[model samples]
Target chain A: AQSVAQPEDQVNVAEGNPLTVKCTYSVSGNPYLFWYVQYPNRGLQFLLKYITGDNLVKGSYGFEAEFNKSQTSFHLKKPSALVSDSALYFCAVISDTGRRALTFGSGTRLQVQP
Target chain B: EADIYQTPRYLVIGTGKKITLECSQTMGHDKMYWYQQDPGMELHLIHYSYGVNSTEKGDLSSESTVSRIRTEHFPLTLESARPSHTSQYLCASSEPMGNEQFFGPGTRLTVL
Candidate 1:
């Protein structure tokens, strides 16, 4: 079974400051990692995915993630955080057994203070 | 943009009442999924379908059932609504071999 973990339950950052949310995943063989964001009372929206190539993947809203195969981590990052960027972030990955489904992390609450 | 839609954005029902949460997508994706999500938590997959007339349970055990009668319609039903079943239900669809899964607005079901 493949699984992902978001170590921090919540991350608070000052507006315009850089922010980072940590994520680590465990899977058999190679991994296909992804990032999703959920606004209040809304379903998750796709941000970006790391299927193959490009260790550093860029996503929507000027977001980017670095996939570290050695550490089994794919942490989301943004250089300048905006108040509007505050939301719930989730890291997910597909199972190793050729399953069409994805296993998601517990989610990290990002709060950007103005 | 993903054109997936979930009806009854909010639903409240009494215990023992039977109800169905409707999910539809215009993307014509062969794969569809249903997930139960609580506030400030990770989503747990309840059910999924490969195509018409195909449905399978997900990682999490759920009392609700789902049916895939059409390529774009996947509805989840619960024979008896229980307070424990109250949560946000999300519908998602993906291409036969696509990487990203497009999600709907989600239906918040509250069983009293």
Candidate 2:
């Protein structure tokens, strides 16, 4: 079974500082990775996905993620964090097989302090 | 933008009462799913549908049941509400062979 892991329960960063949220995955074959952000009392919004090619994938809200195949990691990053960027972030992975369903990680709470 | 909608954003019901949480998407995606989440826990998939008249249980065991009678609507029902069922229920839709999913505003339920 495919699964995703988010190591941190919460990450605090000063506004305008760079931020990183770590994610790793275990799958049978090539992985389809994705990042989603959820605001308070709102649904999750799609940030970006990595299906094939391009180890460094750029996403919405000035976020990007690097997919490291050897380490089985796809960590989300932002050059300069803003207070509005604070939200719950989830990393997901799907196997290359036909299932096409996503296995989500335990979400990481990102807090950007002004 | 994909238009996915969930009704009753918040619900507080008594034990043993039957309730249904409605989910609809106008994106015309052929795949829809239901997920249960606690305040700060991992999302657990409870049910999913490949298309109309198709529904399957997901990775997590859930007491609620779901039906997909139409291509765009997938509603989940619980025969008897329980305190353990109190959590946030999210609805999502995606293309038939697509990996990216669009989520709807979750329905928060509290069984008292």
Put down candidate 2 lDDT per residue, B1-112, tens digits, no spaces.
5699999999999999999999999988999999999987789999999999999999999999999999999999999999999999999999855469999999999999
Name the lDDT value of residue A74 in candidate 2. 99
Model 1, stretches more than 4 Å misplaced?
A95-97
Q: Please state the CAPRI-style docking class of candidate 1.
A: medium
After superposition, which runs of candidate 2 have C-alpha atoms over 4 Å from their true positions? Answer: none
Q: How does residue B33 of candidate 2 score in lDDT?
A: 95
Docking class of 2: medium
True contacts kept of 2: 0.75
Q: How well does chain A score by TM in each candidate?
A: 0.96, 0.98
Name the 10 consecutive residues with the lowest summed lDDT in model 2 chain A.
Answer: A93-102
Give the C-alpha miss distance for residue A31 in model 2, angstroms: 0.5
